[model samples]
Target: MKIDMSNLKFGAVEKPEKIGNEYFAVVPYFFTLKCNVSSMNDDMKKKIGAAVIQKYGKNNVQYLAAEGAYLINARMRACAISPDRKTWKFVILEKEYKSQLVKVLPKKILDKI
Candidate 1:
């Protein structure tokens, strides 16, 4: 499946940084973006969640309320988290690399995938 990055809307996105195999040997392509915001509030989460649902379809997006994250298509993973009060890190791992990393994922996350 091809993910059209342009279709997904976001707020205050900074230039994305390409992630390499040093982080995870299995996934050949990975990248992360920083979404700068004033605070990590419910509204921000709601907006990002909405954008994800809009881009991937509600049926393919699963919201993990406990983790405050969204898992897409059971193969592709997308989640935004606040590392600090002013920055939200948005990480997206392409689905094409999932098969190689399946065995390394925790059981909890693997079950959802």
Candidate 2:
């Protein structure tokens, strides 16, 4: 699975700086990611998460714990399917403490925006 986090909001921690003797400085920071999900398959998702864990270290990816584990399909765009297909919930991130809920907009809407 190709997981692209190109549009997701996220936080990041800075590397620790070593000082002389036994002192060190550590800084924690947060940043939003333009994340994307790709090549979504169940097993592939697991591998992608594992890869993220490896790259960002376990602590960094811990935020995902609240959201649960899911796979990212890089090639797949979040588009609405026919009624016969299962409909999924849609959400838009808000800068405020709370998120804004919205129904899935039609593909045409995306094109306009």
Candidate 3:
């Protein structure tokens, strides 16, 4: 999904905080995905996983379906937008953040990744 950025809307956010090299801002994920995670095939999943790792760096990226969500729900301050992973969303705390995180990245970026 080539996100227009402008079409996307963000929910309320807490005050921003600086963690490591990035500033963190907490916001809610409003189930805005072109497709659902449960239906994606392995190849597709791998493709998305790799693209995410590339943009966010393997060490800095994560996928929180259920368990992962629980783990990050308390302390994570950084999140990748559903599609390209080019945009990073920061949240102050985990309890309030939410997203389906399933957006199609640009074809050019996908080829490079």
> By TM-score, who's the top model here?
1
Candidate 3 stretches greater than 4 Å from native: 1-36, 65-113
Candidate 1 lDDT over residue span 1-113, tens digit each = 12222233333432333232112112122222223332457888688778767766787676567655556653234433343324654345445556754644433333333
Best by lDDT: 1
**How far off is residue 24 in model 1, in Å?**
30
Q: What is the TM-score of each candidate against the true structure?
A: 0.32, 0.28, 0.27
Alpha-carbon local distance difference test for all models: 0.45, 0.35, 0.38
Cα TM-score of candidate 1: 0.32
Order of candidates by TM-score, top first?
1, 2, 3
Stretches of model 2 off by over 4 angstroms after superposition:
1-30, 34-39, 62-113
Question: Between the candidate structures 1 and 3, which one is better when assessed by TM-score?
Answer: 1
Off by over 4 Å in 1: 1-39, 74-113
Among all windows of 10 consecutive residues in model 1, the one with the lowest summed lDDT is: 21-30
lDDT of 1 at 109: 32
